[model samples]
Target: MSENYYELLKVSPRATVAEIVTAYHAARNAFSPDSIAVYSLFSAEDAQTELKKLEEAYFTLSNIDRRREYDRRLQQGTVPSAPASAPATAPSAPLAPVVRLVPTPAAPAAAPSPQPLPSTQPFPAPAFFPQPPYSVTPTAFPAAPSTPPMPPEGVTGAWMAQARERQGMTIEDVAQLTKIPARTIAAIETENLSTLPARVYLQGFLRNLARQYHMDATATIQTYLARIDSLKKGAA
Candidate 1:
């Protein structure tokens, strides 16, 4: 039977070319960034082999003729054939088995002895190692872990706080840098949403703060978005 390429790529057989490319990129990203020699989740050698498989799958699935031929061969329980230009070779001959027969040396016979048959009594019970004394006491299992509470809807404050700390800048220093008031910076860090300007301006302010702090601006935005979403869902 043909190998299941869909399963190898972790995608449905009916997946579009774009979906296959997306899956491949996602797999590539999942690997450790420090290890650049390899691709996907394998050794460099194995990754090369895997990449070949991926390419083959993409190629076969992307072309209707190739896909149909592959499917036809798979259904017929036959491997897909090469082109007419391919050479035909003789069938392989069976290999001969290696055998070594050694004659046993005769032993010197001395005496014949009579032996008594064992009794069919039950076998003695095996002795087990002494174990520590213990008693079963039922105890309630711990409660399932709870998900962390999402950050507040206006987390631009937290972003501002983290950014300033990373930059080794105090609120006064940030005030000098941005010419904004120290109180505004303090309000941003403390997440006093009411003290900040319009909601639209909040994103820009947080983005600038993130750049100054060398923090991930995208992640900061996502956190704020998640918080806002939770609040909208009444989950905040």
Candidate 2:
């Protein structure tokens, strides 16, 4: 949590370098090959700029002397000094406080009332009310349990292996064709869909996988959607 490095990484001053690295990697990995519009927003030049900043921050913090100085300043709770050539402005004078006054009023005389004599009858104690005994029974309200999700038909690791072998396609080949990572494709084939990113990205990945396998992409997406719905229902 160094201010100089945090500023370089465009993160909060209290953020750790690990957090900075995580944010950087998240930005880098978010660029999907099939997303022309998203990729277009960050050109090679833009990427280089961000990479340069990240590298600079890492380099500075990784150095012993620089990091020691930064730590010293952080411990001292001081804002690091600027260059000697920086301009200085004159301090403004403090303003005087305004005063207000109000006219004084005369005090009023006290009024007195006659005290009442004590009564002979004793004060009555508060009466307690008693009720007849009644039976109190507890009621139970149980929630219905959620059902387990069903596995997809004709979709398994063995099935994927057979399909890939039949088509003469390797994991790498599928990745290159679809622009999805091999590990992600492996996760999909293994039906560990939660290992993937958000639902929208998963949908796109599934669509790409279907397209690469020459399967009906629409039907494939529908199947994935149904599986997700079932999973949610079961979890509920």
Candidate 3:
């Protein structure tokens, strides 16, 4: 089986962008060199290796275009998730031999014997373990209306997205121009309330976005914030 980035982050295939961000953060915390929990089970080097993979997966999945393309490839069985089977199998062969290859005759190898065993036991092979198949159905987006309606009096997140597109700006472009983090920008655009900043921060973000798009700041803030409140109330 190839490397599934979703499985790498321990998220389902259909995870939301916010969910992917959350999982990436959690994975980083777990695999960071300073993390003792992971160190207890795996070597600092091994943990770091995992961190690289995590970052790779995060960067790929965080971008909307990259993620959509990746998902398309995955659905078509064209994506290679991990290294080849040979290299993956190569690790096991060396691991058992390395224990025996230890120079007990040359040096004080007493420490090496007991040292590796304890850590090895705790390093559960999650990547190697069998996980139930997660079905990711292709998401079908609806076609836009043939006639573009007049812009509404109340602003919306969708309007911001539309305006950005009209200006031929990608999400990354907006992120760079506004100096907002890409993940945060994506969350705001998608209206993922759980992933959005607090109200105070969001107001500032909305203002920044408004200024960037030359929209009415006051109406942008009021409309978006009011929508947030309505959603929160509905959720409750």
Candidate 4:
């Protein structure tokens, strides 16, 4: 299944880009050598090999153009088959003999004979302790303010800024959370197209940011592309 990118990433061929990203991250973590969950299940070399496959899958699927081409090839049923290999079976180790150890409770000691004793004087009265005076009053707190509504789809930059701020995220915070450079994020929010990368990379950045902000990634990308196209036509 090494040649099958979807299988390597553990995602269906119809998975969305966001789903593919999530699957890639999960697969990479599972095969990481430092991961405690699979530490004993895979050797370092084996982990590295699995990581390479995951990277290949992510790289191919993350790009829109490449994924489109890949999907086309898949529909044509033209994907090359992997070479067959003999099944590898490891010999199972023999089970060790089980030994059960049970401890026997010591026999009950002989009952001690009862001894008669004179009644002792009554114990002194216990002293009283003073308790601290404390009272808890229930206080009602004011409800949190509602966030402002995001701007319309055409105002991409304003929408992005409002969405980020509503989520209490700064440009630097978004950068760290999305792994996008702070400057690039700022450029995106400001609609400084010249400062941003090419359209392909811009699409990925916008999608990631939209996902992080809990916005509709598909809608965000579509609106962003439309805005760019409008600008290009106006300049032309």
Candidate 5:
């Protein structure tokens, strides 16, 4: 009987060029000198013969024109004549055994098969995990604010800073919300009066800042303005 290239490569007849290539590589590696497989079943000379068959199968099937012609010959059940220069070999040469490939429309033939160690040694047991101490119990602390509450003296720059921290609003965040420059907001937070904008602009900025903190805007504006005035007079 003529050789079946698909059977030799262990790839499906419908396999794509890539799958055929993968099967060819797998069959090659599976029979190499370093491979643990095939040593007992086949001699080195037999292995060489099998490799020749494998190369022949792969080359014939890999070519578009040759594959088409081979398929036509295959379907017609005719053995195509070998090249005139090619020396004839016995048709009864021993074939290499390989892992039978599952057909396509499923996982491809390139999937790795796991092989266990040749030795019979047992695996070590996993170590035990330490138990948590039962004497200590987890405790919950009251949710106190990280920053202290505003001073009783009223709307100092420190108070605005504390409120902003409590509100999780950075100076950049306040500037974004109020359309104020971030440096101005920093100046307001640090009580840097020389850098403070005109009172009209600062008043609008304070009202916007107060709205962000969800506080009474008018009270915040009046108290903060009064505090800054008192500080300025004290400085002079």
Candidate 6:
């Protein structure tokens, strides 16, 4: 029930960046407007407020310098408090009593007798003229066969992009399906490893993307790690 960012995300103070990211996603989904789990429990405004808090927590704790500063603040017992609000269970004043008005009774009127209604005779159907029979002919057009998506050709970002395209998936589509950010997905597809998270988190992203596209997750992860190693060696 603590309002601390770590508590809000259900993570420990020493949680890794990958853990923080995972917790952030879980928290976001739990409070999402479209989430059925919280549909009845929280109003749209409340959900949005909680989502904002989750984002703030993630943004702070996911950054190395910010997280270190926050930890220092926590250790010094100087963490900022949330804004104050009205008491939860304040009692309201009782309503004033209402007075009812009485009315005088009126005299009843005599009932009138009902009259019978006139009945109309039904009309007979007319004889139909001769008509031609209509029939629907079934056309037998052959169904076009669907081709399976091709496997990735190599362990490079280009192959990853090609595989994604072959599966007819856009970066946004993959992001939505995988719950990974579109920017992260773009970085992966473009081989911009420097812009991505640590190796563990990057591997997780690759695995999730590969699973979504029906590719071999193990192979994709191994290839991506190998590529990263080569890049590091070249830079060194």
TM-score of each: 0.30, 0.32, 0.41, 0.39, 0.36, 0.40
Looking at model 6, the pairs that clash are: none
- Candidate 2: segments with Cα more than 4 A from true spot: 1-161
Number of the candidate with higher TM-score, 1 or 5: 5
State how far residue 160 of model 6 sits from its true place (Å).
17
Model 1: per-residue lDDT, tens digit, 1-236? 11344555688766654455456555555443445645454666555545555555545543445556545544443432221111233224422331222532532242133222222322222121122121111111122123222235445556556545543457776666556677767766775545755657666766666544445666666676455445446733
Candidate 6: segments with Cα more than 4 A from true spot = 83-236
lDDT of 4: 0.62
* Global lDDT of each candidate: 0.48, 0.48, 0.65, 0.62, 0.62, 0.62
Judge candidate 1 against the unseen true structure and give its global Cα lDDT, from 0 to 1: 0.48
Backbone clash count for every predicted candidate, in the order shown: 1, 0, 2, 0, 0, 0
- Scanning candidate 6 in windows of ten residues, the lowest lDDT window is 132-141
32-127, model 3: which lDDT tens digit per residue?
Answer: 888877867877777777787776677667556667876776665555334311223334323543444466464455544333332221222235
**Deviation in Å, model 1, residue 129 alpha carbon:** 71
The segments of candidate 5 whose C-alpha lies over 4 angstroms from its true place after superposition are: 1-151
Ranking by TM-score: 3, 6, 4, 5, 2, 1
The digit string of per-residue lDDT tens for model 2 on 1-236 reads 11244555556645543454455455445533443544667666555545554544444443334455555554454433221111233223322331222532422232133222222222222121122111111111122122112235724444554445434457776676567888887877766646756778878987766644445666666776666667668877
Q: Tell me, by TM-score, which candidate is best.
A: 3
RMSD (CA, Å), each prediction: 23.6, 27.8, 14.8, 22.9, 31.7, 24.3
* Deviation (Å) of 12 in candidate 1: 63
* Model 5 poorest 10 in a row by lDDT: 132-141
Candidate scoring better on lDDT of 3 and 6: 3
